[model samples]
Target chain A: MSTGLIFAGTGAILFAMGVAGVMLLAHLLRRILAFNLMGSGAFLILIGLAQRAGLVDPVPQAMVLTGIVVSVAATALALALTRRLHKLTGAYTLPATRDD
Target chain B: MTEFFDPLAWLILLPLFWASGAFLLGPTRGARLAIVGVAAQLWLAIDLAVKVGDGGTAIRHAVGGWGAPLGIDLIADGLAAAMLLLTHMVALPLLLYARGYFAADASVARYFWPLSGFLLAGLNALFLAADLFNLYVTLEIVGLAAVGLVAAGGNATQIAAGLRYLFATLIGSGMYLLGVALIYGAYGTVSIATLTPLINASAASAVWIAAALMLLGLMLKTALFPFHYWLPPAHGGAPAPVSALLSALVVKASFYLILRLWLGPFAPLTGTIAWLPALLGSAAILWGSWQAIRAVRLKMLVAYSTIAQLGYLFLIFPLLGPDGLALQAGGMQVVAHGLAKAAMFAAAGAMIHVTGRDAVADVAGVASRMPVSLFAFALAGVTLMGLPPSGGFLAKWLLIDAALTQGQWWLVAVIIAGGLLAAIYVFRVLRQAFLVPAQGERRHLSHRAPPLLEWTAFTLAAASVLLGLRGVDLLRLLAVGSGP
Candidate 1:
């Protein structure tokens, strides 16, 4: 029970940190890392949830695996877009305003 | 053989299949495949609507022949069918317009076919999704396709916009996945129908947290109020048909998820955070419309107008408290706004094609140069402004009727005020179009858009108007299923 509590708590904290990072950070790379952090946090929570069930639940495990794959794809695409933006604009951060 | 005939699987699968083909085969052959695939999708959607409307029962297909709960299930009732009708109807014309708009040598053309097809499949899957986790997967598909389409412009600003959009959507979906995990951990199942009875008042905190997380995610994707910062830049920067799709369908996908959750698995928590959506929605309407009125770019104005239009959808949450009528009113509003917005974007795109400018003032002489495109824009504006003989008018009437019956006079005021605001932004362009510049030389300099492009936009605009008089069919279709 304590193990379950620790893992779930840690997962929630990591997820919250990701959300904050994405919201507060301006740099594009930091935001991408934050997104990945959030995904990992969510996956940790999924794992912790299965642990709490007291038996290894295959369903949440399957879901976590699928989630990892999706996370990879999203991160890859985001990085590609970021690269394109940096190449075109010579900046790794989004402009503070929409005006060009 | 029986499984092969299922439209639900085909609806979600065929476009994905064709998208792969479009990519592997290159654009020349790929564009043709997309045209054929979208046409087939339209046919399939119409067939499903006709069959389901007549049968008065939803059609369900379990993938891999697995039943609900054990494996993924796709269900399409009246709501799903109507949205499908909206999506495919808008897509068909946009496809035709795109055929003319893009030069053969443009690199973006190659990507458009595959990305659009992928987006379509994802949307259909989202509408049909009965499983929460499945909805997440489809959401990712739709989100990625949308970001890809936005980046098709391949410029600095457009890429920045796409990157920002990707971040916003990913965070939203990530929160949603966390919520799904919580719900599954608590309920032991991820299917909405299965969890409907399982989720009760006993676990109100868990349900509340989960619902809040999911709703937050969806609202972010849908660009409600402050979250709408990512929307205009992304939508405005995309090429025209892509803009129409993103504005018309992609945003609606997330909103549809919100509706599904509210009415389905999260039904137990109906009273939880209900008023918040409506409050935020009211703010979105006023702020968005005001911004639209002040916007200089034509596409930006239209994008802001979307934010305003989305506000009315949230009004249902508050009004649904007293009367079930508000739910239908909201659905009707969805159909109305979706059609009108798509038409508006398409016509604006055609105008930009001729004038080679995206600013409302810069395109002043386009009115005379391309009367059909301008007329299409004007007709679509009627619907956006909620004028008579337009579907927007009918939708607002329903919503007002519901609010009045419930003694929600404040909502009535908000509705009217929103309409007036919509009229202001819409007419801001029409007023520009009406300006007769002394120099007629500019008209000669502008290129002529093909009739196909003008007529495609016109048909969508005309349909939104016609939908006003003939909304009974759609309303009847919406009435299916034991609903809120």
Candidate 2:
């Protein structure tokens, strides 16, 4: 019933949804979004579960900050790659494996 | 703070320092700096290994004078030092080879130096990290840097492969972060030294879940079969030197984390699940070798062969016992595979460079024109096939001995079968190289490979074979500070 528990529950749900989205979705942009959602969910769990006992912990908070920065870098890299792929192939999804 | 003199710190800082310097100096100027930086790293690695070997314990340095539980720590045990030594040894020659390989392409070289520097920095940091959160951060650094290197080629296939690689790496690290969070929530500490005694077989369900999550994440990153779909394209599609780095060193970084965890904090939880990785490893050997045998492209064959070689590293997990034979086998496999794979990829790059083609069919009669590269490839193939007087052979000998002592008959069978399967793929490439081209088909002599490229590849391949003769020293080093 505590707030921290509630946040943790929502995080678990978000993580599941994100994983499913990543697996089922083929569009590159949507996959990136799904990846972000997964990051957010993990961050939420990190903060929420640390505070589940009603004690404030700065360690997980610090970790979440670091995680956010890393996620942003990854997101930017993914987006840049997606942009280049789109420009070259004119497709949002990856093409099927070609016979070389 | 006196630990500032520690070589472990320099093993990491030297790479970052040169990486930044290289980025500022531009593409054509970084090669010398990178070579010098890696050479310094090699010396430092040797120094740390000697220290650890003589001291009979791990060297621990707490950053900023803050000890574990409140601050980060770096520990260089025998395993870490061995890996560091291998990293620098492999990287030094590869840097030289890359200088020749990328001589004509400034655009790729521009990013290649900084990215590879960052990659090496991340790898050293990952090896020395003594905590879960630190490991996660280092993993991200290594992953992102690798993806950037893959994408540096700036073509459709390379970019697409890079993107897929980026997604897989992100997911892998994301899952690892979740595991770290769960561990923190359960134990309030992330330091490996502190958590070692706290995590037991009877720990709470959260600890179990965390172990599963962490193991799965690392497995994905290591490209242990079934999760290997992202690896071949990323490794195969990149430029030659880039492919060499990715296949030879990058994947092994994640596998090192897995081995570290299994030996340290997760030791108690590994009893029931020890067979899982080995089972998957057996599958990888069979599947990966089959794929390599069927691969059309030369680099793809080498890349797929990397997957098969990596599977051998996992086979030791099931045979782990008090004698530490399996551990020695794992270490030997890692170093041997690293040296041979680097040589193989570098040689493949040279062949492709000369022929201006990537297909296996295009390499016909390359032996007559490029004897040095072909000899390098065949020597590396000798190691890959686990022939006598090669490090691969010694590693397999130890692994089979361990399995026999443990009475694990199936593992013995898998090891032998894997070796035979490896022979098929290796000879397939060699056979193609020795064959004459079809009549009237003109040989495409697109470009000549520099002597530097051929010599570097040969050096690495020769080192791999030489290790089999002098492997006792490495085994002695591996024995330091390795126990409960």
Candidate 3:
């Protein structure tokens, strides 16, 4: 396979896995990690797309830089919220069946 | 030529600038600054709307004097302007209502002002951005700020709900960013204006995949049916004004983004899956209203009604052909729902404040106790139920006409059923307030809402009705920059 194709394919597979994990797992921490995995997979696709020529595409690089900052902020916020949730409920996984 | 510098950018920047100042000055002073800032932003919004509506041209601005493909740009078309006007109009009253609603809670009020401004900035930025990546960034800001606002309620329920909202929105943004990456890889640009023609020429697979990915992400953010589980709790748990803003403004911003993208770059490719969102929307209407009918809490009922109202906007997606008339129909639906829902939430907040509980049964006899607030609720309900002489009626009329012209009888049935369901839930609230208590069982709350709070909600409800009375001008304004 071409290098770009292989890399893009890997990103796609990782994204699918991350999505499945986020949806299936009830653990909040695991869900956060799955989000990170999703972000990393997306980052990989951006990097792979940028490698189309000898020189990387600067636009996607710029976007990836911004994306990294956003992802970091999101992870931090998710962590903060998770901690708060744990403190409030005394456990991480949502209480059995009471959404309200 | 003035080199194309547009003041439309200030509609976003002023709120952001003031938001920064508000954050620095603290919440009380920040709230005062927000008042001045939102007022200035409203002035700017109206000025831009008048000019754009009159000139019949979009106002485009390139930040830092850099053009597209290399630097970001902002465009204020008729649709974005309509949303801007709606935000400013609704925000000002909500801000005023909040000033009184949280008058005693100094702690929550402190961060509330800045977060609200930041959310408004994020919204205006989302509507005005001309690029996909920029839209993603603004969406992130909107999501984070909304979570912060929802969390501002500070209870365990609110915080947990906010966290769930944050998770859902973050995933949505991640998926949206992936689509942006794919589009850039295929077309070498992320600018919406640039991608319009290129998207039409690109291979069908790449285009369809990107469109599907992006629309999926936006739908999650929009809380369309299956993904709508996070919205009610988050919205219901937030303080009244925050609930109003979240339901009225934030969710609509994401929907507007979907409208902008589909009508702009993906317009040529929308013929394939037009029925999908319509089907989902039909389901959301049926399901959301059914849930609203059974909702025990007042805020949860309003939140579920928001889900149902949002479905109306999506139903016309399949009907939006080259005529672009259905777009105006959708736009009108947005304005109708935004105003009515804001008034409903604000009034509900006032009632729940005095009652000291959110359960529908808890609000019995509050109708005569808080006549102004109950009147506001009933008036907003009139608009929400698509009754005549209200914006909801005009919007529904236009929507039904569109569906009729397109011969979508199933959607027509959904539209009618949606109105009936809305009527049931709305009167459910009113019934609790007005009908539950028998004669001589009348009562009054020891803690009555200030007249300012009552008037604010009434004004918004009145505006929704008055908007219908002048539907021509609003439709004309929406059509200005929406060229075929």
TM-score on alpha carbons, each prediction? 0.97, 0.98, 0.96
Q: Across residues B1-484, which tens digit of lDDT does each residue of candidate 1 receive?
A: 9898899889988899989999988877887888899999999999999888888989888899888767788999998999998899889988887877775436888889899999999999999998999999999999999999999878887888888899899989998999998888787789888888788667757667888899999999999987998999999888888898898889988998898888877777777667788889899999999999999899999999999999989988867743457777877788888888888899998888877778878767667777898898888888888889888888888889988887878888888999899888887887788785524666567468889889989998998899989888888888777374
Q: Ranking by lDDT, best first? A: 2, 3, 1
Residue ranges of candidate 1 with Cα displaced over 4 Å: B321-323, B438-443, B482-484
- CA lDDT, every model vs. true structure: 0.86, 0.90, 0.86
lDDT tens string, model 2, B136-220? 9999999999999999999998898998888888888888988898899899889887899999999999889989999999999
Q: Assess each model's interface with DockQ, reporting 2 decimals per model.
A: 0.72, 0.73, 0.61
Output the number of the TM-score-best candidate.
2
User: How displaced is residue B140 in candidate 2, in Å?
Assistant: 0.4
Q: Listing candidates in order, what is each one's chain A TM-score?
A: 0.90, 0.93, 0.87
Ranking by TM-score: 2, 1, 3
Cα displacement (angstroms), candidate 1, residue B290, comes to 0.6
